[model samples]
Target: MSDGADTGEAGEPGTEARPGLVRRFLLGLIVVLPMSAALIAGGAFLYGKWRFNAPGPAAAPTVVWLAPGHGLSSIAERLREAHVLDETGIFRLAVELNRAAGALKAGEYEIPAHASMADIVRILREGKSIVHRITVPEGLTSQEAMEIVRADPVLTGDMPPVPAEGSLLPETYNFSRGTTRAQIVQRMQKSASALINEAWPHRTANLPYKTQREAIILASIVEKETGLAAERPKVAAVFVNRLRKPMRLQSDPTIIYGITGGKGPLGRPIRQSELDRVTPYNTYQVDGLPPTPICNPGRASIEAVLNPPETNDLYFVADGTGGHAFASSLADHGRNVARWRQVEKKAVQVPVKAAEERTAGTKPVIPLKAPARHVGG
Candidate 1:
């Protein structure tokens, strides 16, 4: 009986212990293996995210302009070629997620080297871009201004009919790529109108102009006559004095404008015979202001005409000093003209020799004059 009991007890314990150990081993393996695998996968994902989001080295990079008509695929390809973004597929996904495929503006854009796909998409969606500057110098005619506008490759659209003279302002204009020529012209007009309105209230008393247009006409003449900023009001005073005396304005640029038909720049200097031309723009033929302005005048020129300096001087000649010689009397003007003729004669004497010296890259001798001063005599 004792031997049988010991055998049964041992057999029962062995059978129970075997199943309990197996169950424990399997349970531990099932939970630990999955947990370990989960930790590994999480670490890998965190590493990838950190690598992509880290700040990059600072360096100057070239910028690329995305033109107005380029599609998303085209822009992506260009960005990839430039190495701005690592993966075009990722960029496409970002663009699609933001729904910004149609919101991109055509302009000059500066993309940083190795910019992230997300950053590029954000830049496009915001419509931020670089603005280009174009400066229109004072005294250009409307036709001349139009040519400059058309020559710019960034500007777009068909040009409209050229506007009347003095309708545009001369100043620096900021524009975007793909801007229209007509839009530029309109901006100029708006600027001109604003300037005229602001300056009209401050005009000097007893001005001969019956309207703002007349003032603009005279201002245009002053703009074409002198490049010296200090000399503008003095030049304007001469024309104003002439208008007060009901005498001819005798502006040479006006005569040239009539001869050229406003098609292009005047090539040659004015001749004595052409001054006698019967065109309405010829101030020597017509006793009053021309039918319109010959060129666009800037703010300073317009203001100079409206608020002429207190002077009675009425005649001026080039003093060969990059400024003009001013006189109030015919006798004084005659002497000034005589001196100018002497200078011209000397200049003509050595023309061929001067040409040879210029071709050889030698500085030509230029005569200097005394500092400009007011001459009442």
Candidate 2:
């Protein structure tokens, strides 16, 4: 029994004592070493990513003023140098990624320094830049347009040599502040070209004018001749018919344009002597269309020339109601003219003035008789 007990305690078959010291040490090492290595590698990876991905401190706000004609590379460099972008290469990459490389608009922009690449890309892509609006009214000469551009605070630089009269189309144009006057003038020229090209395709056939420029010149005359919108086509037709018959246009506005040189507004009414003035632009003296456009014709004026009113009437005179009376025969014109003159005389005889004067005057003043043929035609 003692022997069996000794064998069991020394070399037991079914029971085992605690593991050897070295074996225990190796098992503990096997579990701890890999866990320690994995923890160290994870910490290192996280630190590396944080160090690379984190951006630097916030930068100050910076103003980026983009003058006219500045290219994209110059603007990008400016942003990079201002520290608005950490690297221009990164910015370019971002622009390419967003497909905004070709979408950056030319204008002034304000970017905060140390702005993220994403922010800069958004600003350029969205074109949140400075904007200026210039309104050019109808019937203004190129010189008048230049004066407007020169006077505007948003536009910069001097006007180029004055464009041909009526070459610049009158419309509202949008540009960036600080854009050059020459650039704006060029834009006007382009607009005029485009408008004429587009309108020429739609013009009526068998017209008097051979080319679009002549049509524009005639339309300008018609625009300046009347303030009534409904009369534009009629006035255009009058000129067109006269041109077809090779008769003198005899338009009074042409005479005024010759006298004023298209610099300032003609503040007063036209006179007879001015109408008789001999100038290349004076339709009263010249038989055909004017040498050039007298004023900037608007789209309505252009369309009026393109499609003139169908009428056999050649003579038109103010009917004292903001519209003109059309007459086909001299006799009919005479009657209309007489009626218009009577209306004018009656309008001039103000009721208040006549009543007040009648009480003051002791001797009755004989009213002068208007001439039988003295009427507008």
TM-score of every candidate relative to the true structure: 0.76, 0.65
Number of the top lDDT candidate: 1
**Which residue pairs show backbone clashes in model 1?**
none
Predicted candidate 2: what Cα RMSD to the true structure? 10.2
Candidate 1 residue-wise lDDT at 175: 88
Question: How much lDDT does candidate 2 score?
Answer: 0.75
- For residue 210, give model 1's deviation from the true position in Å: 2.5
For residues 1-377, what per-residue lDDT tens digits would candidate 1 score against the true structure?
99989887776446768888999999999999999999997887565455445432324464767776889888888776766755566556556666888886666677766555556666677777878877889989999988888788778899888889999999999987778889998999999999999889978888999799999999998998888999999999999998898778888778878988677767777777887668899888888899889899999899999999878788888777678898888899889977876766676666666777889999766534422222222
lDDT tens readout by residue for model 2, 1-377: 99988877777453353457668899999999999999998897566444334452236677676544655677678776766655565556546656776777766777755556666667777878866799988888888888898888878887799999888888999987667889999999899989989989888989988898898898888777676777889888877777887778877667767888888767677777876668797676778988988998888888999989788767777776667787767799888888887876876565555667779974444343222111124
**Candidate 1 regions with alpha-carbon error over 4 angstroms:** 1-48, 54-60, 67-78, 89-106, 117-128, 352-377
Model 1 has an lDDT value of 0.79
